[model samples]
Target: MSDQVVPAVINLDVPGPVISRHLYGHFAEHLGRCIYGGFYVGEDSEIPNEGGIRLDVVEALRALDIPNLRWPGGCFADEYHWMDGIGPKQDRPSMVNTHWGNVEENNHFGTHEFMALCELLGAEPYISGNVGSGTVREMSDWVEYLTRDGDSPMVRLRKQNGREEPWKIRFWGLGNEAWGCGGNMSAQQYAAEARRFGTYCRDHGGNKLYRIAAGANSADYAWTETLMKQLGELGCAYRPQPFMQALSFHYYTIPGTWQDKGDATVFDTDDYYRTLAKAAYVDELITGHANVMDCYDPGKHVGLVLDEWGTWWNVEPGTNPGFLYQQNTLRDALVASLHFDIFHRHADRLVMANIAQTVNVLQAMILTDPDTKALVLTPTYHVFEMNKGHQDAASLRVDLPAGVPARETLATVSLSASRKDGKVLVSLSNLDAGAPADVELDLRGGALSGVRARILTAGNLQDHNTPGAPDTIAPRAHDQVTATANGLRVHLPAHSFITVEGRLG
Candidate 1:
C-alpha cells in the first residue's frame, strides 16, 4: 500500500523571497553579433581583448556568477540615443540600428562601452531608457548623463566622454517594449510615460535610482492592469513619490506563432512537447501577472521585471533574418529549467529576471567567433552554471506531490528550493522525455548532511555546445542522490537538469 510518490516536502524554516542576486540576471542587446561581434572586439582586435572588451567574453561572463547586466536593449532600448554613444571613437555618431538588424549601429558599443561592460562584469547596470524616441528632456538628460555629481550640463558631457567618476547606475529601464517596440503606448499612454520618465530619474550623488516601468507583452493582463492603475495614480499625483520601482514583463518561448518560431536546430518528440508546453507558461504568466498586480498592488509594491525571457527559436540557418541567431538546445536547457523554477516560485512577486540574451542573441549564454576566436557555452549556459547556488538564497518552501504523474503531457518536475550559505539547495527539472523520476524529497526543518548531485544531460534532444564541439552538453558529477528514511532519494534523468546539494548543518 505504498506506491511512493510522496516525499516532495521541504521546509528549511519555510521562508521565501530572498532569491534575488538580481535573480541571476543578464541580457545584452543591440542584436546580431550581440554588440559588434559579441562583446565588442575592437581595441585593435586580437580576440582576447580587455579594453576593447571580450577578455574571452569577460571570462565567460565572470563564470556565470553574473548578477546583473541588462543594457542598450531589447528593441534596442527604444531606439537608444545617449548622445549617440558618448564622444570620440573617431567622433562617434553612428545610428540606424532601427530596431535590430536594420544594421549599422557603429556607435561602437556606446555609453562608455556599456559602462565599461558593467565594470568588467562585476555586474549590475540595468540601464534601458529612452522612452520611445526619447525626451522628457531626453530622459532628464539621461539622468544627468549617468548619475551626476555636479558641474551640470550632463556632468560636462560625462566629463567630455571620458568618464570622470559618477557612474553607480542602479537599475533604470523605464522604457523598453512600452507595449511593443516601446512606443505603441496605451496602458494610459504608458502610464503617462512612466510618470514622466519617473520624474527626472535622478537622485545622483550616492546613486538612488531603481525606477523600472514599461512592461507587458505575453498574457498582457490588460497591460498589467493599466500599468498598475496608471502607475498608482502617478504615485499619489506626484508629491515626493514619483515611484516606479519595477513593473517590466515579457515572456518568450513561442512554439507556434510569431511567424513559425519553431526550429532552432529542428525538433522532434512533438517539438519537445511543444517547447515544454510553451515553457510551462511561465508559471501561468507569473500567476496571471500576479493577479493583476494584486489589484493595483496589494502591498506587493511593484517589482516583477522579468525583463524579457528566453527561447524564441528560428533564425540560425543562414542568419540575418533579423539577427536573432539561435542554437542552444537540450531544449534550451529544459526551457531554462522551467524558468528558473518559475522564478524561484515567484520570489514574492518575482524581483528580477533577465535571460533573453547574454551573447549571440536569444537563449544565448555565450557563442562567439569574431572570425575564429571561437567559444561556446550553452545548454542554457549549463543551466545558469548549475543554478548558481540559487543566488541570494532563502526561498525554501517546496511541496509538489499530488500524485506525481504527468501534468498532461510533459512537466514531470520543475521544482525550486533554497536556503544558501548554510545549504539546502534542491532545483529539479525532469520534464519527462519519457520517465525517470524518483524524486522523493521531504527534507523538512533540518536533516541533510551531504547529499550533493549535479546534472545537465544530453544524449540528443538536439544536444548542443558547439565551438568545435564542446563538452557537447556539459555539467557532470551527479550522484543519484541518497539518504532516505523518508527523506532523500533521487534519480531524475531521462532528459535532465538536477541540482540537489544539501547541508543544514
Candidate 2:
C-alpha cells in the first residue's frame, strides 16, 4: 500500500449524459426456484401475493427502482413458446425445463404473467426471441402478440389471452447465446438469420427497436468483431433496418479455482481479493469490445449490453447443484458496487447490464423460503438500493488518489459521480479491502458545504446474511466524511462501498 496521496484536481464541470436506467437492469430466468417458488408461488401461498407472485418481493424490487429485467430464460428463451402461459392458467401446457435441472415447467407464468410482473415493478421488459429452435414466423408473431395494437392474428390472440393493451416492449434480444446454448451457429449464419428475423419483428407501437444480437462468450473478442463486421455500418442499404441496437455478452466471476469454485459464504482473505480482481475484468471487456465496435461504427449507435453478469459458485449444500443457486455475501456486494461504478464510468458504450437471475437464483436480490415463508434481502440488494440514484442521471468522473490497494489482489481504485435534482451523489469503492484509502473529492470545481454519507460494509469480507440472521451485513449511516473548503474528504474503509449525498444549496 502506498502512503503517498497524489493531489489531483478533477473538473466536475464536464457532465456526461444522464445515466441510462437500463444500466441497472436485472434478469429473471425460468431456471431453479427463480420462477416457480422465487417470484411466483402459484395462487395458493399464505404470503400476500397477486397471482402467486410474492408481494414482499415485489415491494422490495420496486423500492430499488429496478429499470429493466430480462425475462424467460438464459437458454430457455430460445425454446420458450409465449402462447403456452397465457389466458387460463389451468389450460396452459406443461413442458420439461431441459436446460435447468429438467424440472417440470407449468404454463402458469406466460406472457401475461411476465408483463404483469414487470408492470408491478415499473420495469421495462426485455424479451429474448427464440431464433434457435423456433421459425422466423414464430419469432415475428410473438413480437406482434405483445406489441401490436391492431386486429392481427397475433393481436387477436392477445385479446383472447385476456390482455387488451399491448406491452410496448423496447429491448428485444434477437437470440440468447447463439454460439452455444442458443443453438451453435457460425457468425455468418447467425448474422444472416438475424437480418431475416429482425426485419419482420415490426415495431407496431412505433417504439425504436432495440434488437440485441447474441454476443460472444467471455473474452471472445473475435466473436464481437465478426458480428460487428458482418452487421457492417448501421443505416446502410445492405444492413438490416435499425440493425441490432446492442450486442449481448455474458460473464461470471468465480473465485478460487475455476473448476472447483469456492463457496460464496466460506472464503478467506485470498479468495475475497481474488474475486474482486476477477470482477474488475468487466471494464476491460467493455473497453476491448468497444474498441472493436469503433472500427466499424464510430457513431456509437450500437450498445454493449452486458445482458448477463454476476458471481457464480457451487450451490448451497443440500440444494440442487444444477440450479445455479448460491448465497449473497458482503463479498458479492463489493463485487456489485465495483461493477456499478465501472458501468457508470463507461455509460456511453455500456447502455445496460443485468445481474444474472433475480430472486432465489444466482446473485439474487431477494431470497425466499418455501418452508418457512421467510423472505430475506441479500447484501447485493442493499447496494442496488443505495446506488439507484445513478439511474438516468448525468455521470461525473471522480479522481481516486493513489493509496495502498485494498488488497494485494486488486491493483487500482476507480470512482464515478452524478448529479440529479440538485443533489450531487458520488459512489466510491476500494478494490483492495485490506488497506484504508483517503479520497479527496473534487466536485468539478464546485464548493461543498453540508454533506452526508451512507456506507455498506460488513464485519468481515466473507460475512453474509442468512434467514436466521438477515441483517448481518447491510448499509448504515457514516459520519466519516468531513466538510472541506473545496469539497468533502472521505475516508473509505477497506473492502467497502460508500455513497455521499451533497445538496447544491
Candidate 3:
C-alpha cells in the first residue's frame, strides 16, 4: 500500500450547526419488493413478522436510530390514494403499480400500516401526498384523518376505520417529481400547485405539519428559484406564514448513463472512482440550489430537504428489470460515507436527507430473502450504524491542511467530525483502491482521550454480503489508531470506512 500522510485538523471550538437527526432519515417506497417481501411479509408467513411487518428488518434498522421514514413512494406517492389503503385488509382494493414493476398492489400497507411501521421503529413519518392523479380535497382529508383529534368528519371516518385517536405526522411532501414522474408539469406550474396544496394541509390538534414542496430533479435550479420566489410572495404582507416550510430535490449517483447504469458488483477500478466522482457532484448540486435559496431567503428560514438520494445501478442478473434489486458492496459503503461528510458540512441550510430506500431497493440498508427468510445487513448499513453518532450532534470543523490527495477521478480521502454529550466522533473514508492513508488529526479546542474505533472493509471493492455469507463485509473493532501528543493518528485502509470515538475534555 502506498503511504500518503493526509494531515487534518478538527477544531472542537469551531462548532457549526447541530446536524439534524432527521438527516439520518430513510425512505420506503412501494417499488419492487421493497414493501411486499422486503419489509412486509404476510402476517401468516413464517418470517416471524409483527402484523405483516418484518421484525428482523425492524431490529436491523433500529441500530441505525432511523429518525424519519418517507412513505408511499418516489413515483408511487403521486398515484397513491390514501383512502384506499386505510380500511380492512381483506376489503382493500388492489391496483396496478404503474410507476414500478406494474405489479398488483393489494393496498394492505396503507396509512395505518405505515404508521404501525413508524411506531415499531420509533421513527417519525414523512408522508408524500398525491398530486398528479389526486385532488387537493383528497390530500387535505388525509392530513385531517391522520392528525385531527376533535369531533370532525375526518375524525369520524378514522373512528369508522377502527382507530379512535389520530396519529401524529409532522413531515409531508406536496408531490414527488413534479417536473417529470409526479405530473410532467413545468416548474412554474408546479409552484402554483404547491401553494394551493400547502394551504389546505392544516395543522390539526397538536400536530404541526412541515410541508415540503416537490423541488428540482437534479440540477434544475430554476425549479428551486421559482418555488422560493413564490414562497416569498405568499408571506409578503397579507400572509404571515409561508405556504411551504421546506423544498425537496432528488438526485441519484449513477456511474454511467441512466439507461446503462453500470452493474453494481461488476466494475473495474475506473468505474469505482467514476461512481465516487458522481456522488461527489451532489455537493455542487446542493451549493447551486442553496445559492438560489439564499438569495430569496437569506435568513435560511426555508429548509432544503434531499428526500430522495443514493446510488442507482443496473438490477442484478435474473431479477425483474422493474425491480431495482442491486447488490450493495464496499464501494457503496464509501459512497454513503462521502455523502454523509458532505451533508454534515452543509448542515446549516440542508436540514434533512433520506436515503433513496431502506430495504430491497436502490442502495438499501437491508436485503431480505422471501423464500429463506434470511436478512442481510448491507455494508452501507454498517456505515449508517457507525456514523449514527453524528445525528443531532454539534458539527465540528474538519480541515485538511494539505488537502485530500486525488485518486483517478476524485479525492481519495473524506473526513467529518461531530460532538455529542462529552464525546467526539471522527468519521473517515479512504476511497483509494490500493493505497492506505495516514491521517494525522490535530484535535484543537478540547482534549479528548479514551479512543475507540471500528472499521468496515473487505478484500475487494465488489465484495458484498449474500445470504450464504452475511457477515463477509461487516465492521470490526479497529486497532490501527494511535493517540498522538495533540490528538490521534489513524491508519485508514484502502476502500474502507472507519469511525473513531473519544471522550471530550
Candidate 4:
C-alpha cells in the first residue's frame, strides 16, 4: 500500500433523494426461453415448478425482493394482443413473434399467467399495452379486465376465464418504441396517441392507472422534449387529461455500434473498458433527459421512466441471433453496478428502471439450461440481491473528491448510499481492471457502529458461472472492511462491486 491517503466521504446528516423500490425492478419479454422454457417449464414437465413457473427461479427472484416486472415485450408489447392468451390453454391462439424470433408464440401464457407470476414473485406488474397494432378500446378493455371489480364486460370475461378477483396493476405503458418498432411516429404523433389511449385507461377500483408514454431511444433528447411539450399542452385546465404519469426511455450499452455489438463471453481488456465507458454515459443520458423533462415539468409532475436499460452483446455463436442470450461476466457485474449507481443518483425523476429480459435473455439475472433442471444465478443476480435493501431507502449524501477522471471513461470509483429505517447501505464499485482502490469513508455526524460487507468479483475478468460449476462466481464475506477514526475504511478489490451495510447508531 502506498503512503498516500484518499478518502471518499459520506455525510449521514445530509441526505439525498429517497431511493424508490421500483428502481430495483426487472423486465421479461415473449422472446426465446425467457418464457416457454426459461421460467415456465409447463406443469407437466419433469422440472419442479409452481403453477408452471420454475420454483427455483421463483425463489431466487423473490429473495431479491424484486419490486416491479415489465412484461409481454420489449418490442413485443406493441404487437401483443391480450385477448388471445386468456382462454383455455388448448384453445389459445398462436402468432409469430415477428419482432423477436420468427418462431411461433403459442398463447399459453397471457395476462392471467403474468399476473400470477408477479404474485408468486411479490413483484408489481408494469404491463405495456399494444398501441401500434391495437385500438384504444382494446387497451381500455384490457385494463378494465385486469383491474375492474364491478359489473362490466371485461369483469364478466375475467370470471368466465378462472380469476375471480381483479389484480391491482398500477403501471401501464401506452406503447413500446413508437419511434421505430411500435410505429414510426414522431414524438408529437405518439404524444397525441398517448392522450387518446390515456382517456380510456380508467381506474377500475382503487387501482390508479400510471399510464406511461413510449419514450426515446438513446440520446434522443429532442423526442423527450417534444413529447413533454405536447403532453404539457394536453394536460391543461382547458383540456385536463388522465394520469400520463411518466415518459419511458430505452437505452442499452453496447461496446461497439449496433452493427457489431462485439462478443459477450470473449472480449479483451480494451473492449471491456469500452463497454464500461459506454455504461458510464448512462448518467449523461439520464441527466440530459431529466433536464428536458424539468423544463416541461418544472414541478416534476411527470416523472421519467427508464423502462429498459442493460447491455446488449453479440449473440453466442450457434445460438438464435434473434433471441438476445448472452453470458454474464465480472465486467457485466461492473456495468450493472454502474447503472444502479447512476439510477440511484437520479432517483427523484427516475421512477422505475427494468433490466432487459430477466431470464435467459440479454444480461439476464438468472440463466436456465434449455433441456435441464439447471438454474444458476448470474453475477448480476448476486449484485441485485446484495443491493435489495437500498429500495425505498433515502439516499445519503455522498461526496467524492474530484480526482483525475479516467481519460477514456468517467469516474473509476462508482458508489451510492441509502439509509432505510436505521440501516445505512453503501454500494461501491472499483472498475479498474488492474488496480485495487483504498478509499476512506467520512460519515459525518455518526460514529462507526458495525459494517458488514459482501462482494461479487472473480479472478479472471472473463470469469462467469457455468452450468457445470455454478459457484465459480458468488458473494463472499468481505475481509477488507474495518472501522476508521473518521468514519470507515474499505479497501476495494478491482473489478468488484461491494455493498457495505451497517446500523446507523
Best by TM-score: 3
Q: Which stretches of candidate 2 lie over 4 Å from their true place?
A: 1-8, 233-241, 401-409
TM-score of 2: 0.95
Over 186-233, each residue of candidate 1 has an lDDT whose tens digit, in order, gives: 788888878877887777778888898878888888887777776554
Candidate 4 clashing pairs? none
lDDT of 4: 0.86
After TM-score superposition, what is the CA distance of residue 383 in candidate 2 from its true location, in Å? 0.8
Worst 10 residues of 1 by lDDT: 233-242
**Tens digits of lDDT, candidate 4, 269-345:** 88888889899888999999998877666667787888888889888888898888899988888888999899899
Ranking by TM-score: 3, 4, 2, 1
lDDT of residue 328 for candidate 2 = 92
- Expressed as tens digits, the lDDT of each residue in 1-505 for candidate 3 is 5778998989987788999999999999999989999888878988788999989999999989999999988899999999899888999999999988889988988888889999999999999999989999999999999999979999998999888988889999998999999999999899889999999999997998999999999999988988888876532242214569999999999989989999999999999999999999999999999988888777788899999999999999999898899999999999999999999989999999999899999999999876777899999999999999999999998888646789755889899999999999999999899998889999988888788999999999999999999999999999999888988999998889999999987
In terms of lDDT, model 1 sits at 0.81
User: What's model 4's lDDT at 484?
Assistant: 73
What residue pairs are clashing in model 3? Answer: none
Candidate 3 minimal-lDDT segment of 10 residues: 233-242
